[model samples]
Target: MLDAAQEKTFQNDILDKIQSHGWLLGESNKLNKQLVLYPEDVIAFAKAT
Candidate 1:
């Protein structure tokens, strides 16, 4: 189990690696998105069948 400082450091290191990979960090507008999954698609599919 990591302490607070260690956890922060690990998170930063992971983010740095992700940025280096050139996909998630700079490619994104800013930070992680707050995504939500609505049931609309499932409901629509069920209705169709």
Candidate 2:
């Protein structure tokens, strides 16, 4: 399990990245989730979920 400080550091890093790069983090998450989804359906599913 992660310690409190490690978890806080991870969250801070994610927040910092999101603040610096407008929605790229969300997009990357969408892309990662789509790895198991159909190629043509990825975008639609990404937006829906």
Candidate 3:
């Protein structure tokens, strides 16, 4: 689990990347109601990868 500060930093980094790139598709875990980066996001990261 991330501490408060770590969580904030992590969220900021994600927001920055999304702003620079495009929208990311996230998958939601119904059990915990937590969202995670989806496979589609990884594929969208790079075209040559």
- For candidate 1, the per-residue lDDT at 4 reads 100
- lDDT (Cα atoms) of all candidates against the true structure: 0.67, 0.68, 0.66
All candidates' TM-scores?
Answer: 0.48, 0.42, 0.43
The candidate maximizing TM-score is: 1
Tens-place lDDT per residue, model 2, 1-49, is: 8899999999989899888976433444435464654454566778899
User: Which candidate would rank higher by TM-score, 1 or 2?
Assistant: 1
Q: Rank the candidates by lDDT, best first.
A: 2, 1, 3
Output the worst ten-in-a-row residue range by lDDT, candidate 2.
23-32
Q: Per TM-score, what order, best first?
A: 1, 3, 2
Across 1-49, the per-residue lDDT of candidate 3 in tens digits comes to: 9999999999989888996787643446422334444555556667647
In model 3, the clashing pairs are: none
Show where candidate 3 strays beyond 4 Å. 22-49
Q: What is candidate 1's local distance difference test score?
A: 0.67
What TM-score does candidate 2 get on C-alpha atoms?
0.42
